[model samples]
Target: MPLITLQNVDYGVGGPLLLDDAQLSIEAGERIALIGRNGAGKSTLLKLIAGELQPDDGEVRREGGVRVARLEQEVPQQAHGQVFDVVAGGLGELGAWLAEHHRLSHAQPLDEAALAAVHARIDQANGWDAQRWVEETLTRLELDGEAAFAGLSGGMKRRVLLARALVSRPDVLLLDEPTNHLDVPSIEWLEGFLKRWAAPGGATALVFVTHDRRFLRALATRIVEIDRGALSSWPGDWDNYLRRREERLHAEAQENARFDRLLAQEEVWIRQGIKARRTRDEGRVRRLKAMRAERAARREQVGNVRMAFADAEQSGRKVIEARAVGFAYPGQPQVVRDFSTVVMRGDRVGLIGANGSGKTTLLRLLLGELAPTSGEVRRGTQLQIAYFDQLRATLREDWNALENVAEGRDFVEVGGRQKHAIGYLQDFLFTPERARAPITRLSGGERNRLLLAKLFAQPSNLLVMDEPTNDLDVETLELLEDLLADYPGTLLLVSHDRDFLDRVVTSTLVMEGEGRVGEYVGGYSDWLRQAAPAAYGASSAARESAPREPAPKPAASPRRKLSYKDARELERLPARIEALEAEVAALTEQMSDPDFYQRGGDAVQAHGAQLARAQAELEAAYARWMELESQGS
Candidate 1:
């Protein structure tokens, strides 16, 4: 049964319809992704489905006994109360109603029977256990046993709110950009959690609105796109949807082109002394009319967003180089140590590590925003670096988008160059009207896109971006990837987005703690295999650390022999081998899983380890078989 349904819904303002005659049916256990431009009514549609807002017209119906929960943006007043109390408040209204009903039922003086009934009802509803669930949920969210909620950071507080909503265990869950401020690790954890939460036959149906392509591709089984007040449906994952969308766009463009050609032909015929004989050649006219009708029915493709980095003067081969770089804030040990790396011209390097693992700090080192506690930070002669901080707070909130990109200063060449700021903004997909809207009104994703537009507008040979894809919509992200791929200058990017890194970067600079930067030959996937050997297997780790050994010839029986020693050693071998095999199998399964492909390095590494372990296991099995045969002989 459909958990919720929207019939011919219309949502709009004084200007135009934001969501037109849209119809949606959300099934039980369906994981739907809501996608659209910033002001395309994705959020507004979510509100309508959650019943927080009524449709401008038409009806929204929910299945009987279905419960919906939305992540509340405004923390309730009681949210400031005890953490336990705030979670309990989800059931507070129900509890109060039940208590009143019981009181009314007992017309006479309060009796023991009446009091027992009330207590029993409360226990059955699990109102008293709200604190327990709060603790468990918070623990899972990595906010367990915090000294106090008031002291928690904004990101932590958002986690608390998520916990409260999750503990309610609603039949339908509505999350709006749930990963807004979550670091890479936290987002990974949340992805795993949501998968379990919305597993087949699970009680929850998830409808998430997010610009995170990885998250959407991992979680969404169905994608609902809202565009210009109209809704369209796509079956399967985001990749599949994109493929189909592209095909549709191509067909539409061709059909429109054909119509345009026919129109031109007719105009030419009329100009060349042809009679107005359309009435006599009715069939031909009808065909032309049909073509025109079909052409009108098809909508034009929304042009891909443009991103052209300003041409900057070429720098020396080595742009930024750090030698034995280490940084530590006051009152703490070093956060990054021995971080040495060199970014060369035309190099596309991705910086990756756990959150607070110094990815940003490394970017800072390159930008000269922070001084290394030890070692040297050097930039080659004529090096030009442009940095994009993940947080867009540095942007102008009071001014419009165009003005923010303008930087309150007209384009002037520091070294014999001149251009207008408006011209630059246009290259980044800002229209005259859209660029005029205040930056404060822009959505997180829009603001991030705007920041990229502005940064790219300034000419620089080296681009140092920190979490550039954090809140960017998938469309914009893909466009950025295309731009970066074409860019001739140096690139240093810090992002947890696997797809972006794989598509744009040629090398990876890994900031593994202990003050060292691990420079790997390939992209993000290469870095992972080097980091976690356990992921491959125990033997693989041994082989990696030991000196390289040549492959034994197939006929070298002695080289392939298994040395059997104590019973304990023999007993452990088979079990260990089996465990390795199982690990390899699991990793293989994860890679094949559709969700894993949507994720970054984790899946690819898992897949690679699986292959490596399988090879080792085959070798081990062959040796074991040989030993058994020898013992039999």
Candidate 2:
């Protein structure tokens, strides 16, 4: 049986319908991805499935005794207790019982009956080990259980909420943008976790809304898209969904064209006037009116996000140059060091790393917002930089959307002319009514759109965007891709969206946690391939020389023909391998220390050389050991 079912659901009020006659059935162990344009009711449908919102006109049915847990985009403001207690709240009644039991235990003489009652409640809820489970889950998510919830950052708080939802281990999990505010490592962990949760033989089902295309491709077995108040289901992964959706749209267009032709013929018959009426064509007239009414009732498809940056003056050949740049806080170790890169005009560079790896710090240094502790930075005379902050900090909450876009000016210069602020906003798909609405009233995606509209209004030769893909809908994302592809300006981007990086970047700058940074030629996938374990054996120079298959190994000699010295060497190989591995690990750990980079260049180079030598020796020992084993020695 399906875990949750929504039959002919009709939602929303007097405004244009959000969901009309939408049907959805979520079966056990199904991993479904929900996608749609901004303001197209994806979140609303999740709420309905999670029982947070009821359908205005139809029935929502759930299997007997099933539980649904939902992780929303925003963390709850009231959950400001200790992190441990907040996550334990997922246990519901059992949490309350545990609390009461503790409270009564501390009272004088400890009421035995009260303790018994609490024990019974805990047993009934099957939550005797709930605290331990919550703590383990919190640790896995890299959250400190003992910390105060109010003291945590927004990202940390979101992680805690996610931990709570997972600790519950519900029959159905509904997640909305689970990857937002997460670092690359955290996203990878989440992907693995969800994959395990939806594995075969598991009763758990999932429905999530996300803009992370890689996440969709990894975990989604089916795609459910809400478009123009209608729901369509595609039974496959992201690539399959895209192919089928395109084919379906094309077929729909052809049918609409045929309907239009038939309507035109009916109009010609009606134009015959009195002669057609005298021929008793009343039935045909009624049929034509019905057809017109049907066509009028059909909803027009939603339009794509239209985005185009204003043309600006070209920048110099050298946009920005960094020479052995290093950055460190006062009396602290450097977060970025010896990073030298030349960014030229029209270079699309993507900066990527795990969280706290100084991606943003490097960007700030390049823009001259922060000075390097060591070395110098040079900027071209024509470099005019426009920055898009992920936080949308430039937007004013008190002002209306139109006012924010206009800043303090009465007009916005577009296409070499002064266009009215409202008219400019209309080009971005904002109606006059929506333009007059306060910024605080807009949804997250809408606010992101407004930020983009504001950023592109400025003319600049360099565009630096930090996590610009966050909170943007798919349509807007595609439009941003289109704009960036055609943009003539130098671009530097920091984002966790791998698919976006692959689509928009010509090269990638990777921050390997410590002060180490490496530049890769292509995109995110290219870096992954080069960083694979097998590829690690190949020196950086050799990998860059050209890609090729590994060479075949030589045939093994007979084990009985092995000499005494060879036998002794084979016995000692394991210890030698262990020592080399330990030494290499130590070198790697030292490299991750920011203080280690503060040493002079000679010492750093010596350490790197020694590490490389040890790795080479270890590889040779492994090869010999493998050859010996193949001979049954």
- Largest TM-score belongs to which candidate? 2
Model 1, span 1-633: residue lDDT tens = 567888899887665677778887776556789898666788888899889899889999998898888885344554654344344345556535343433445446667776677667767776555545555665776664423567655556666777777766688899888876565555666777787788544446899887777677778867888876888777636776888778876896787788789877865654454356543466766766776676566544345566666678888988888888888888887877777777788999987766656777777777788988888899888877787887776687788987777767877232234556666566555667778887777776678878887787778988878778766667777888898898788888887775677788999877656656678866655555445523222234223533333555577345344445533455566776776777766654553343443343333344444565585786787577556655431
Candidate 2 structure quality by residue, lDDT tens digits, 1-633 = 567878899998567689999887776656889999888999999999989898999889998998999999988776866777678777776755654665566568989998888878778877768856776787777787668889876667777898888888789999999999876656766787787887533578889999998888878866889998888877535765787789989999999999989999998888887877689568898999998997888787877666667668989999899999999989877888798999888999998876666788888899999989999999987887888988888898889899889987878876567788888888777989999998888998888889888988898889999999988887789889988998888999998897899899999888875577788877776776555422122224323434444556688555665578777778888999999899877876665453553455346446656765887999998989877655544
Most accurate candidate by lDDT: 2
> What TM-score, to 2 decimals, does candidate 2 have?
0.80
lDDT score, candidate 2, position 424: 82
- Which regions in candidate 2 have their CA more than 4 angstroms from the true location? 96-127, 139-143, 150-155, 408-411, 415-419, 532-633
TM-score of each: 0.72, 0.80
**What residue pairs are clashing in model 2?**
none
Q: Which ten residues in a row have the lowest lDDT in candidate 1?
A: 533-542
